[model samples]
Target chain A: MPPAASPVPCKPLFFDLALNHIGFPSLDHKLPVKGAEAASPASAGEANKPDQPGGLSGLVKGLWGWGSKK
Target chain B: MAHNIKNVRIQAAYAELKKLIDQGSYSRIIKTTNKIVNDDQSQPEAWQCKVVAYIQLDQFKEAINAINKAPNRQQMQFELAYSQYRLNKVAAAIDTLDSAPDKDSPRGKELRAQILYRLEQHSECYTVYRELLRTTADDMDMERTTNMAAVQVHRVELGQCPVPS
Candidate 1:
């Protein structure tokens, strides 16, 4: 009986080599976390804020606040 | 941290394998693929598809393995291509992607994106999602937009639901 060829070495999984297709830099380090930074409005500042979800009470406060500003 | 370290080790090894292949140490790829084939259960749709991909430059070998290890006759090419893509066989992936059937194209990208996403490669998924939106979408822009928004809300990676605007 012929000897089976030594099962070749297990190759690496090469995770980020696939990312080369998408043009992300640093294949070995640093993936951008989605929405982590943009989730908080305070750091990004008030003028840049998109509408936030507020209950009816907050809406009343907002209206009053708007009147006070004028 | 052990599992994370192990994962990093595996990734590094694969990168080395890819580097060897790129450096014209091509014979190692065959040996490497053989190893993967043996360590694995030869289960269809498992990572065995990747082994088949490295043989693309050799049509007969690639075709044979692809036919044998493929999940199905239909999905074989894309599966193989996805594997090669992982191994940094970029040209091979593009070739496989191109030769595959039109119906298979979306499936191919989805599978590739899926593999990447599982590895925590969300950026690639985002790229593929944008490309898929091109072919899968139609004149109904508003509807597609609404549907995708809902899909994002659902956070289901594989679902291709079209939301109503």
Candidate 2:
């Protein structure tokens, strides 16, 4: 008579090597335009400061202050 | 300037693909990789990503097809063998692994040991596991030890001594 099959459930250690091998360009570096845009808002905010005593900057600050009061 | 724009577009596409992979969005990976490969058939990484996505989806046949489309079959032998193993094409899987350049790699040995176990070649499996345990560090030796123990149990069940030593 043939022996009974072993009950131990031995299975293959399946894994994908492609996950490690498939290389893609790193996304760590921001695009030049994106970097410029990120800096724009901070500069624009500084320029719109109410303490600035001059032309377009002061005019924009006055409008912003007036709008905030309403 | 044109070349730089094209490079940026390629980088953006890869970034999106990486995000999709991290999220386990296999379907989206397939779609995105398909587009990338269509634009450049020479992109082996795109083919690999598509194959991996198909495997994750349990579509072994599709995975095999994608592997076949890869620019370099030698580099994808492990993937081809793995998909074959999953599909229950055991003999073919062994053949594929045998043809691989790095067939002696740890991963390749592990897969081969598993295949041997499936084929009821317990002694051969035990030898493979033993070699793996010898070469690998203690921390990574757990799986090899467990597999070797299982193989030993089978050997004893077959009325053979667990180990000659």
Q: Return the top candidate by DockQ.
A: 2
Candidate 2 stretches with Cα past 4 Å from truth are A1-70, B1-8, B138-140, B162-165
Worst 10 residues of 2 chain B by lDDT: B138-147
Note the DockQ of each predicted structure. 0.02, 0.06
lDDT of 1 by residue, A4-57 (tens): 878763322322322222211122321122234446676566535346666887
Clash pairs detected, candidate 1: A12-B14, B147-B163
Q: What is the Cα-based lDDT of residue B9 in candidate 2?
A: 71
Please give, for residues B14-37, the per-residue lDDT of candidate 1 as tens digits: 555455545655456555445443
All candidates' lDDT scores? Answer: 0.48, 0.74
Q: Is the docking of candidate 2 incorrect, acceptable, medium or high quality?
A: incorrect
